[model samples]
Target: MATQPREESANMGKSTWLAFAVHILTASGALWALLAMVAAADRDWPMMFAWLGVALVVDGVDGPLARAANVTEKLPTWSGAALDFVIDYATYVLLPAFAIATAGLMSSPYNLIASGLVVVSGALYFAYEGMKLPDNCFRGFPVTWNMLVFVIFAFPGLQAYSLAIIVVFVALTFAPVRFVHPVRVKRLRPLTLAVAIVWLGSAFVAASDGMQAQGLTGIGLAGSSIYLLVIGALFQLSDRMRARSAE
Candidate 1:
């Protein structure tokens, strides 16, 4: 019976250490965001996207890590979710908005306006109570300006259309559109994860090519993007039909 106390203490120590590691992992994205911001300020699209890529990776895995670490149970006082949201806002919304505003994608005043719209809508979306639906899909457009802006930067041809794209997405933020949480959504998870992985690979390729590509990587990126857009709507349609039939 004497060893019980030692065992419990060891377990507690391990759990506490894991919680701290998860928090540190989540916070590291902020540093990545800072680096991305610096690159954006220099109008270095390739370098900016590279940094954003690292942040994206950190964001992707930290959720699972936090869950495994039992962060909430181990550190009841510290809100991992809140910390994640703060980091996400900085990396996903603010940094991307800054990039858009500075990329010269749109004409002067308009670029600033568009960037402002992105920031405002994304912030609102993050705070929204109904941001996600029961199916693990995002309720609307999901405030993924990082991905959108990355695409625009990758394809120089899309720059001229940046304003239109931004306006459409901002509107879609509340337009009853369904955006899938690639990893969280259960429906078609295998396909979704496979495509998402390919998308990330293409992202690496896109970065290595200095945002100028002429190969399968570019094609894979485009194809995966189109799939990401279409799959959720397809699932939404299925859901609507099931509901109608049940009714």
Candidate 2:
């Protein structure tokens, strides 16, 4: 009877470990999808954006899923942190830079100069702040905003305006602005979940339609962008308010 219980316990342990492995695999899969989307942007850039949107959705849930499965505690600290940073850099920085280059936005001499300046400035600012305030809040816009800019510009009708806006935002990313970081609250959890679902679903819808249909694409891109922008603003404001109260 003791042997039987021991065998069952062993099997349970194996199952738990397998569940953790699956979570890690899913996270890695999302990263690859993000990379693929950026690479595909050259030919059908909007389609790539759509895929990226889907990956973003997957990322939003992966953490919760891991926690629920009780696998988060089992992950090795170094391995997990390293993977997280890699995914973050790939999805936010490298991919957006690739998309900008592939879209030929930098072909014009003026645009080339502007793009180069924005990237260099952002890099220098990031390096300086990262080195100085290694543990504190970020000094500039997060690179994830680049994904938002890409999604906006990838749409057919919004293409022209989106390009202009993206250029401006690219500069802002390097600007000296202190964006707030809000705490996650229970009341806002539902709204956060809704945003993720809608944004990800819109991407799939846009991709299925080939992004050539201006009306549908416009709705999706605009809706997603507005949703994210509002959320970001709200989060920042809330964080600032909380900080003031604590002080």
Candidate 3:
């Protein structure tokens, strides 16, 4: 009777608190990025990436967790997307850019320009209104410098191409290509998610070995990365072909 109203109120408060906790999870990424910054400053690339990986996992889960908790409905005042963007730019762009500039991966002027372009281009990429497409794909390269830098560190051989990589990807920042959002975008979602997991697992193993991914681990990382990078474009092409056939 009277207890029914009390129980319902208690349940409502519980949902609100759950949403608040989700926000806290999102904010925790900033702390991980801070630690990663320290590691990068000390030239400890592996440890820095380990922290970044933790942040990545946090970022991945927080979106769905926020949705499940109905954070937008409960905490309309707080913008999870805004907070996420801030954290993401720091973790995905800023810290990796710092590492590139500091790690001596390239010669003087090239390193200087490449790292500078990373943050600059990353800022523009994330701020652009059309950065993400309606189908949950990124409209352009999406400024994944963190992943690119990790790959460079893993294969030391890529050091020769560091400058070119930056220049090309920076140009691609505004290109017409579609980049996969992995766990989002329902087409081939199971395969995409599996590839993402493989990539993450490979990342962990590489981080453990001082960011040097060798042997089969290297192959797994490369394969999964290629799949993620190309899948969205494949989807876009498939749709275009289907539309042409219909016409």
| Deviation from native of the Cα of residue 196 in model 2, angstroms | 2.7
TM-score sort, best first: 3, 1, 2
Over 1-247, each residue of candidate 1 has an lDDT whose tens digit, in order, gives 9999999999999989989999999999889988988888888878888888898888888988888888899999988879888988888889889988887788889989999999999889888988878988888888777888888887888888899999998999988878888888988899998999998899889888888644798788888988897788889899899999999
Error of 1 at 53 (Å): 0.7
In model 3, the worst 10-residue window by lDDT is: 180-189
For candidate 2, give the lDDT of residue 137.
Answer: 33
User: Number of the top candidate by lDDT?
Assistant: 3
RMSD of 2: 5.2
lDDT of 3 by residue, 86-145 (tens): 999999999998888889888787777898999998988878998878889999898888
Full candidate order by lDDT, most accurate first: 3, 1, 2
Cα error, residue 32 of model 2, in Å, equals 2.9
Colliding pairs, model 2: none
Task: Score residue 231 of candidate 1 by CA lDDT.
Answer: 88
Off by over 4 Å in 2: 1-12, 30-42, 70-72, 109-140, 156-164, 167-187, 238-247
What are the Cα lDDT values of the candidates? 0.87, 0.56, 0.90
